[model samples]
Target chain A: MCGIVGYLDKVGTEGGNVGSVLLGMLTALACRGPDSTGVAVFGQHRPDELIAQIKLGENGNGTEYARKIEETGKEFGGREFSQTSAYLRFVFTETNDLHAFITRVEATGDPVEVVSVGRRLEIVKQVGSPSRLEKTFGISAFQGKHGIGHTRLSTESVVDLSHSQPFWGHGYPDLAIVHNGHITNYHQLRRRYEQRGTRFYTENDSEVVAVFLVDKLQQGRGLHTAIESIVRELDGSFSCLVATDSALAFVKDAFSFKPLVFAETDDFVAVATEEVAIRNAIPGDFTVREAQAKEVRVWSR
Target chain B: MVEIDAAGRTTREVNRAIRQRIAESCKEVVLRNPGARHNLAVAILEDAHIRIAGSAGYYCGGLIDGPSIEVEGSAGWGLAESMLSGTVRVHGSAGSGAAAAVRGGTVVIHGDAAARLGVSMKGGIVIVAGNCGYMAGFMAQKGTLIVCGNAGEAFADSMYATVCYVGGEIANLGTDAVIAPIDAGEAQQLEKILSTHLPATLRSTKPAAADFKKVVAGRKLWNFDKREWRTWQEAL
Candidate 1:
């Protein structure tokens, strides 16, 4: 079982100590999953630049991999912009074909994991504990209004930075998902998406949720509708947390099998697989409520 | 009673300390600032009295095998979830899934509960003093859900074998869910479960407790054998 957490600072605490606070939340869940860790930070973003975080493994050559990423993103007028040890951020214009550009970039690859794509999103994940990820990726230095994180045990896939969670909803500029529990119908859904040329970066079912949600939104559906549709279409026992540029939301399968608790106050709204993450991240006396099965709630900053 | 300051410690440290202390069979440990941090005192198997001074975050006293845990204030979701045995008392409101999937134990909530109060409950006794939200006992397999106040819609939909007592109005019931009379044995059971387990303020007399309408599973519809499956379509 993995740990999933999401936070939205409603009382103007945006761009505060989200990095350290989220790190503390992830640290609280270290017991749940220590194999790999990830966080999709919603840092301040300019509207013009659509950024994507790529984890293609060093490939024995950072320059070569980085050049390959740059080359792959040639469509959408992709530009080589920033680099970190964990991810290469590619900037493109909003006018690009979000679906086709992300699809093509993913198809022509050494199996790169596009963690998240959004104007404000920056996903940092690694093959280690929460502390290791933070220290290695400088996660403590980040400041964002809202974000979602995951700590995984890797029961299905091999442990690696690429297989880490907080899978970005490819093509959707501001969408990310962190889920706990299995999507049993993953293979069935994957087959349909594969036939249509949707590239998958990991064997874990959580990634499929991210891709599915983005595709739903791409069809011009609102965020809440897309999340509600998940309970109807996705067949599994999952407690998932989603984050957009403006909202942070959660949805549980009809079984209520997975545990997800949410705490809200005028100052902030936080959720986790357990209450400790909410308390650790935003220590307060807020009452914690479990998200009901097939239930959905969205918090906006 | 021992007191812990949860101000700066992570859930790991706090839970570790709790587990370690309870393992030593500490008689009483009071947790301070028990605000919404998760997995506090989870899976404690001791019979100790672990009290929380303020509101507790998610899964407070979760998976507790045996303990006389008391929270002076409200508790976040899934309070005493999957509890094996013992008594957990929440003096204030509780979030969703208060006693969800409980196997055995006595959970008493003095305040209202959010949705799915006892979803998938297998066994045990859950008593909610105030109203409970929709789908209170969704898919309950076995056990007793006692709601003293009104229950939201679909209270016991698709239930298996759980006995539900609704003292107030029931918005609706799901398929195969129907009202049953509170027999003398079940009435005594309710009275005993509520009076003996609840605090003095929540206790009610036998006659008053008998005002509830009992809800049980429609067992005949659970599974259809080959013989019944053939004629099931026309029977409806």
Candidate 2:
């Protein structure tokens, strides 16, 4: 079973120290999953700037990929270029088309994949523990309004960055999700979405949740309405946390097969698969309650 | 009386310290800063009083006997599971599968309990001061489960000789779980049990034992018959 953790600052106290809080919570849940760690942090919103993160292929030459990315950035008017070992980050003016920019970046050859593109959302995932995530990306240094994370235990998917969770809604800006249980109807739903020309980035079952939810948002449904529909439509044992630019929400399946607990105070709200994570990472007293079957709650900034 | 601090200590270390204290004939052991840790106290066959100051994670007091354990905070899943004897009480709520497969014991929860409470209990008494989640007492063999508040869907499904009593509304009964009328004598026994375990303030807030609805298995699944198609259909 994988572990899911989410933290949202209600009072907006200087980025909420979200990075450090999420790191500690995920570390406490390391025993649940040892395959990989993934986090999606929603930072300060820029109305006219879009941030894009890309994962380079494992076998490609790093220098070659970097050179290609730099050349593409020049043509696309991208700025704030940052490169990690296997990932690249770029900020582009919002005047550019999101789909076109993603296409242009992936066209740089070397099997480039866009991890996420949004004004406030930045997703980073790698094959390692939560501590490894800190060493590699200094995740605790990230300051943001809200965030969600995942510790993955690969069930049917391969252990790789692409298969990792906290999946970004590819076309839906500022949308990310982390799931704990398997979607029983993944294949049927994937086929239906594929027929509509929806591009699926991963073979994992949980990827369908991001696509399904983004589809609802595109249909002009409110976040709460969309999550409620998840309880009805999705068939399986799942407890998922979905994050948008301004809100964080969790939805549990009707069967209550998967476990999810949340602790809330006036300052912030924290949720995890187990109370151990919340108690170990968060100080102070707050009553922890288990999310019942078909429960959907949203906390907004 | 002795005190053990779980701060910055491994589970094995904390348990070792507890066993050491017990060996030294400490009458009472207080563990602080439990931090919702898993398997805090397990396989303790000694007679002593153990107290957890804060929350505990999965399997807090499992496979134990002859010790009265108390958790001042909420407990995670599988609390007091498979305990042959002893009493495990939590002042706060409990996660799923509380007291699962216990052979003998009394597990009491003062707050609401998550799903699957007292599942497959061979022998024991589980009392919840508040509501319980879905499918509680599923496949239980022999025991008593008392819910002072509402019971969620499919209560006591496919059980064997396990008796249930709910003081509040039941969302739905499970397959082969039939309601039986409670006699005055049994109601008095329930009242005594509730009074012995729950505090005065808590007992005042919940429904009295006289109003509890008794539930038991119809035992049709124990020996199947082709003519009982409706029961067989739902049981499958």
Candidate 3:
């Protein structure tokens, strides 16, 4: 089992303390998962610029890897370079071929992975708990309109930076997903997607959700439609939360095998695998309710 | 009445304090600032009243032989599960598996209940004043489950001698679950149960007991018959 959390500022004009709220929620749910923690936050959006986070593997020289990534950025006219631990962030102009650009970045020496590429989304994940994430990245000080966080317990997949979730929707910018339960039909779905030439990145079953959403969006289906289709097509006992640049959505399987609760006030909306997350994170009065079986809720800025 | 503050204490400390107060002959114990912590007031064998001022986490009031536990806010999963005898009443909703496998008890939810309510019960009376989610009373054995609001899909699947009543619309019945007519005595008994557990204001807003539909096992699942192949296929 994993813990998934989503928060959105209903009063969208001001950027609330999205990061700190997410940290509080994730920390409360730390008991659910101890392997890894990650968050995908939506920051100030510039329509013409694209932001990307690249995970430089921990095995190599940090400065050397940063320099190589800077060189690659210069090749693509990327600017605003920043580094946090093993992660490198840069802004580049909108590219016509994102897949080729990501492919180019991943080929830079030893085991470079592109964690996320989006106009407003920036994903930071590592192989540790929420406290470790906070110490490493100071995640609580982050301010934004909305974000999604996850603490993962590796049931079938290996515990590593690459296998951790808040999985970016591979080529789909600004789309991220976190899931709580296993996808029973992962192997069959993987075979079908692979036959249709979809790349499988990690052996993690949850990764398929992001890819599936990307595929649906490519087919011109809206986000809500894609999520509804996921409830129908995906065979599993899962409760999933999906976040994009402008909206957040929650989806549960027919059986509702996983636990998910949400609290809504006039000011903000918060959802987690347990109500304790929201109660401990946010103060004041709010109505907390459980998301029923085969339920989907969406909030947009 | 004794008040135990749970603000800065661990779960073990709070439970210990509760048991300690009961040992000291405190009749009524009120837990303040519960903060949705799990396993509060679990396995208490004393015959006393415990009131949780705020929301509680998983397994609240579980494994208790005697005690009337009240929650002002909601409860998490496995609320009052495996109780030998007692009453667990939640002013707010309940999480999944409320009153699961209870040998004897009364579990009441003033608001909605999530999935798997009263699942695998040996004996008890489970009541939800509001709606309930899917697979509620699934595989339940020898108990009475009641839902005042709408029942979600696959209600009461694969039960053994467990009687169920739904006051609102049932989305769909589960495999081998058949609806039988509710007799006058059963309806009056349901009314008495509701009045005994619910407050007057809350009781007035709910549907009358006479409107409820009774659901029981068809007994086809009790023993496998080759002629009932289709029913057995779905049950499996």
What is the per-candidate TM-score for chain B?
A: 0.90, 0.98, 0.98
DockQ of 3: 0.74
**Pairs clashing within candidate 1:** A115-A168, A118-A173, A275-B37, A275-B38, A276-B37, A276-B38, B36-B57
Please give each candidate's TM-score: 0.79, 0.96, 0.97
lDDT of 3 by residue, A216-299 (tens): 999999999999999999998899999999898999999889999988777888999998998889877565778899999988
Clashes in predicted model 2? 0
Summarize candidate 1's per-residue lDDT along A54-136 as a digit string, tens digits. 76563323555667778767656688656777467778877656666666655645655566788888888888899988777
Task: For model 3, state the Cα shift of residue A50 in Å.
Answer: 1.3
Candidate 3, residue A35: how far the Cα is off, in Å: 1.0
Q: For model 1, how big is the iRMS in angstroms?
A: 3.4
Candidate 1 chain A: worst-modelled 10 consecutive residues by lDDT: A55-64
Q: Which whole-number lDDT from 0 to 100 does residue B92 have in model 2?
A: 89
**Worst lDDT 10-window in candidate 1 chain B:** B227-236
Off by over 4 Å in 1: A58-61, A67-80, A90-92, A99-113, B1-29, B33-49, B54-67, B73-86, B92-105, B111-125, B130-144, B149-163, B167-177, B182-212, B217-236
Q: What digit string (tens of lDDT, one per residue) describes model 1 on residues B179-206?
A: 9877788788787777787666666522
CA shift of A30, model 2, Å: 1.7
**I-RMSD for candidate 2:** 1.0
Query: Which residue pairs in candidate 3 have backbone atoms (N, alpha carbon, C) closer than 3 angstroms, thus clashing?
Result: none
